[model samples]
Target: MSNDNCTSNVSQSIIGVLDVIAPQIAKANGLLFWGVILVGVVVGIGTYAPRYRRHPLIGILFVAATTHFLPIISSVAASVTSTELLIHTILINDGLNSRVYCTQYAHIFLIFVWAGLVMMVAVNASVIVVGDARERRNIGPLKAVTGAVVWTTYLTISTLVDLYREKVATIQFIEQRTVANVTVLGQLFLIMYTKLIFKYYAFYKAKHSFAHGRSPSLVDGYMDQLQQLGDNSDTPTILKQGEYTEYDARLHPPALIVMGEDNAQVDNQPYGNRLKWIPGQGDKVLTLDRVWKLDDMDMLQSPSAQPKYLVFSFTLFKLLRCRFAKYTISSASFTKTQKFFRYTLIKGSGAAGERAFRIVVDELSFLHDYYNSSKPIYYSHHGFVIFNIILSLYTIGYCIYLMVIYIVLMAMGYHHSQIYCSDECLGEIFEADFAGKYSDYVQRPPSPVPCDTHADLIDGSKCTSYTILTWHIATTVFEVQQNQQQHDKCPHNVAATHLSRYCAYLVACYPELLTDNNDEWCKRLYEDAKKEAARVLSTPRGATATYPLIVDLLSTQSTHSVLKDGASLGKQLVDSGMGWEPLARFWSEMILYVAPSENLEAQAEAVARGGELITLIWAMLSHAGIDRK
Candidate 1:
């Protein structure tokens, strides 16, 4: 009986200890309940606010406002609940002087709340700052007011919860209710945080996927039209029949002589522009269809006219790989703060602005190439590889850093900026060729000619005539003609000839794509070239004239005097040893770069019009990493 009594006394002592600790646990649960509500409100605001509309970072700012108020709202509720719980405990404890009292658990729970509050503040502040940078706007006042409210509420709630714990009586009823509240709060926090993380991850993954798949189409419909034109005729007409007239027929009597003028009937067969139907013994006539030969015509017509996929050389692939790797590494090395500055403040403009800038730079570069064929040092294949590697690595690192920052901020109740640069932005750069110094964010080498520098010397009229002259020179450069053949052999002449004509085609049909601000100049140039071509065609024995002889005649005639006067720019290039080969390569590359850089919105609007050769080249350049912004 004595042992049983001792055991009963021990049990009573344990029960007494529990009674003392029960009130503290209940107060801690109340604090936890408010914490859970804070988390729920923050998550809810962040998730829905960013999706409210599509205007840069406006939605993100809205999120910041809502999240900034989370602590204030939670703290006010906590204070009121603490007071109610304290009064209830005192009334239920039989007025036994059982007052509310602060405990170790209450301090620890307040620490958690304060820590959570600080985290939320940090998150909201970061979102606001970054969003402002990205959108080029300021909403600091909103952030400040919200932050003040949160801090005030937190201090007030802390005092009330502390007071409630210090005065409330320890009781079984309060303990059970508090425990249930804590359990529910913990579960809700887990669910909400998980959802927030998943949403951000999915968004980042989608952007990455889109960037990887943004290769442009390398071939278009223009090549097919050229091919059809080539296939219908075995021998291209070097000059129209009207170019040769029967003025006196004194220059070449052997060729111009006819057996009978009545039977020939001017031979208007239309089959051969240079061929003439001369009366033979009977009504038959011998047609000289292959008299004047343009060697480059055969080469130009040999290639397939349809659009084709780009096939990069092994060297090109290695160069591009190195560039991409370098960009990734450099980007990875950026500090969190640096990344925030870059993505937020530096690259704040949306994708549309970035693309527009790219188009302007590309158009400028295209015009520059028409007058200047000197390639930049960085344009070499080796330099291209190294440069791109550095750029790509930096981009990669920056992207990764951004992802981390986004995740952290979102977890802390800040919403991500919705107006991120997309694959379309990258696509514009790739299609546009190298970036220019005028770009706000991208650092590029200074152009030899500034984008705004108007080359008045390179009007459309001069460029068109120069192109025609270049084509003529390229075609007959290696011909076997006895009197006109030069000893110098240039393998690139054929390529130069084809590209020259193509440039002329672009100048005539798509002048706006090259220079939106100089449409009048292009139109004047086309009309002048057309008139000059007609004049050349009407000259006596013009059909039989060699390219060099034509150049000599053009040089003397005031109508085509630009060729000799240096206004055409071809004489300068020729004197500098940038013969047809180098000039052709430069123009070809320039044309290709400019085609896709034409305002993509404009191109999309005219999708039914037809494709351009420049588009094909743009795609090839993109595939090769040569045109990356």
Candidate 2:
């Protein structure tokens, strides 16, 4: 009886041991195999992290490190760790058989994806910190920090949702699902709130600045003032620190002289506050918000207190001086021509902004009396300089810190082992363990086409056809150009066809145009002179250091007035229907012909609208000019 009982007990013990050890052994083997590979990839990536910014190779290293190592580690962890440990410690799994174990692979992918996202965020934050400090000196550090916090919070929440759903399987688990969903939703809400706050605040600040004739914000104001100072013309001639000079009450009476040296003495008659008055010179009145400087002789000229006002006035003064200088420097042949033009225009003109600019009127008065005798010494000026230096260093340090923290966190969150190399494998791995729908969202599209060849231009004939098509389509107010027989739906213009046709026409019309010596032919086809002149005119007024043509045009008072007014008039004309149409059509055709189809849509629409508007203007002009010729 005892022998039989012993044999039965021994067999049962062996079977029970095998049953318990089999799954555990299988999990252990899987973990060990993946763990080594993950470690190798992570170490390789980390070694090359510092070089990421300099070369594309480093970027590859970083991507591989985060994507591959994280997944491998995650996979190993899921395989090795018990379900209870995963649920309690890692916040993953449900007590739902082997399915829970299989779903745990998502946790591995979650970790790596999160690693990539965090790294990107960190890189962006570092860039912002460094860039803002250098470029936006007036904006306080608080602004940048606030933006970073808002952005980081959003990213963190997004990552958490990804982690919960993919890695932990919390999306399917009732106990953890509610918390996961709430975190995901809360993150989204916070992003929206932050965006709204930033947008409205920016708008308010801009409006406030515009109304006050100051910059919209403190930073903007400072930048504007600095720009003004940099561009101030009068300040440069009179004093070294003309922009910094303090202007006070004791100043000159207006209308001391008109032009040239002031040799004539006027009787001290009572004007405003017992100031002497000159007959031809207009009265000088102080205006608020205008910048002025007290000269060495301690007489006021431009405006006082506000530095930007002074700079702006000085710029205007310089412009006038430049005009006079141009006249003096004119060639003998040109001088007679300019003088004749100026004399005739001046005969009928009213008092100009320049002609009335007479304060003490002499070179000595301008040198001594217009500029401030003493300059301001503000503590703030020094403080600002010091602050800028400190801020620059601090910004650099902070960026480095951000970069390091990001890399470390990314390394911690994701390792190279996490990413799936094959789409088929990924789909199978995820779907086999979880629902098929879980894999759908993670699916990636194929790589895009690589750019290689340069584009060829359309020939004159093709170009002409394209021009005609544009003109024809534009006549319909951008309504989809319909076929004559069937107007039921908007027809696709397929502008590419027109472009091809035009290109063919250009080739046929001037076959030699394709040759290297075809510059003459190209010149005939393209209105190069007009294009160049328009380009010159359209360039921003103050951006260039020198504008010889602008200076020449401004030499005469009437011409100067005309040029200034012309800019405004041109802007108005271009904004109206006549200007908009041609511009729209040209841009549309250029885009449709030159750019990818996806990018051509907006350009085509613009072209069609512009052509239509231009045609209407042309028709109207034709009717007015020739009476329906």
Candidate 3:
């Protein structure tokens, strides 16, 4: 009895202290929860033969999510506690109207905050709570089990204190939050359901499709009409037929862009101003038909020509894609593009004609679950989707509740304090790389370049993080320089912009996928770039992290850094007068070029976290038997 009394006193003391700072805690929780949503939804799955959750951020964020998010339940519930305190301190002499608004109108925002916790879990559970056995082994389930217990305990404590009715004013709201979390789990289970249903059929289909000459024929009908536009003598003039016009990609490939004489047709389209069709590097091969090297930048300024458009790496190992138009597609869509490229192979060289293309999911968890069948991967819960579907339906009610309340609150003009802490309002606080790191998010304007940067300064000739950083900076500058009116005409601006940032994020945050080099090289170079900024901008070394300050301090002397080369590239791109077309194609190819990795272990790890586009491209290329080895 004495021990129980002692425990009760201790608990009350903690609550007394919590009551003091709980309001501020609620505000912070609201902000962080939204940030997690912004990063997760905006950057869904995307990767390779690179690595699994190698970057510290993946593990760091996962542990942080489990530990930090548990208390959010109590903090959210504490909103009611806050209101009671408000009533006693400020509304003591006020009437029923004031007390009602304090209890009802003010605390309605708590619903949104509760939803935020559920969302945080939804975003993380796929990565943290549930993963392949290998990932589970590494991450361990103890953290998750502990977190769930803490979350429930917090809720239970609140209910116990306020008798379930006044525990933040209602019990159903808590129930709603729980249902929202479970619904997310159910939806995730549904995904796993489909994965379990089909095996590696896509891989086999892709290989057989290529071997049998059933290439990417989807665009054949659409492209034939476009090819006819180039039938006249005008077509020959526009096509750059050099001495060494063509070489089999199996032996040699070009990395330059070519434009037409009459730039009107190509210019109007998304890929018109972009592509690197390496100037005839003396690459020699007999013409299969009307083979023309598209490497001249001069074509953009030139006159009209037809669109016999097909952009692909004409080689065996680099079998990435061949697309028709400007649509960002699904996994199925990416596969279709690769299938189409086989036609180009058949036309380009008979020697390479018999080979098939290959692509895989190329991440660790995916491989373990599907490709890496060395161990028995139990499909123990594969049949759980039925139960999950029912739970998923319950989520609809919570959504309606949030929406209705949002409308009511917005109309009431009750938006203030925590209500104003929206993703947009708190958006700039997130780094541009974080925004770009997850390709799903709409691209925020990238970090302002302090000054012009240089490519020569970074080791971009090889697939290094420095290359990504330099190009990312250049891409950002070029994107910022675009004319607002042209945003729609070049539908690919968003693609290029997002890809550039995504690559930057990969290099800066996730480096193992891009290079076999040790991470120290990337960090050393990154620190060097910062030091260069400090030197050129004349800022203290300690303050280098301050982006705006560094930009303000930028000077002509900063010409030796990545910022200088990037600026040079951006200026060249701007002067080239092509819209985002070239950049779109450039990134399209750049991403694929880096997709082939010798590091299979790293790739498995990448899949375990969240996949990358490069990984998918690598996997697809794998189907074609295009490998680094």
Task: Please list the Cα RMSD from the true structure of every candidate, rounded to 1 decimal place.
Answer: 29.8, 24.3, 20.2
Candidate lDDT scores, in order, read: 0.35, 0.30, 0.40
List residue ranges in candidate 2 displaced over 4 A: 1-196, 208-310, 313-402, 409-415, 419-629
lDDT of each residue in 431-503, candidate 2, tens digit only? 2111111111111243342321111122233443223322222322222122322434321334433433343
In the range 1-629, model 1's lDDT, one tens digit per residue, is 24344334333433443455445444444554544444344433332232222445655644554554555445544543343232211212222222222223223333343334334333322221111111121112234334544454455446546644674424332344455434433433333233233223332332222111110000111112123333233312311122323332111111111112222333222221112323342233211112212233353554442101011122122222222222221222112212322332224457633433343334334322211221221232344446446644654564465467448646844232211111211111001111111112112232242111011122335454344333333333223132244645555766654565555555555555552446567656555655665576457755676645554544565364433332224334444644556655765654654554434433321221233555445433433224325
Task: Give lDDT: candidate 2, residue 122.
Answer: 29
| Tens digits of lDDT, candidate 3, 1-629 | 24344334334433443455455545645644544443343223111111223458655644554455445555655553454421211122222111110122133334434434344334223321122122222221233433443454445344335533554433232345545534543443333333322223222232222211112222222123223432343333222223341234322222212212111222123322221223442132112123334432333443332111222322221122222112222333223233444444333554444322221322223344333221112232233344344444544554566568668746855433221111111121110110111112333343342332222122357445666666666676566556433455355887877777666656555567775467667656655665675466454532542333333333245754576665566556667887778878988777777777756555655554456667666665654446666
**Clash counts for all predictions:** 28, 36, 55
Please identify which of the two predictions, 2 or 3, would achieve the higher lDDT against the true structure: 3
Angstrom error at residue 556, model 3: 24
Error of 2 at 521 (Å): 16
Off by over 4 Å in 1: 1-483, 486-491, 541-543, 560-580, 605-607, 619-629
- Best by lDDT, which number? 3
- The regions of model 3 sitting more than 4 angstroms off are 1-53, 57-62, 72-125, 128-157, 160-390, 405-597, 603-629
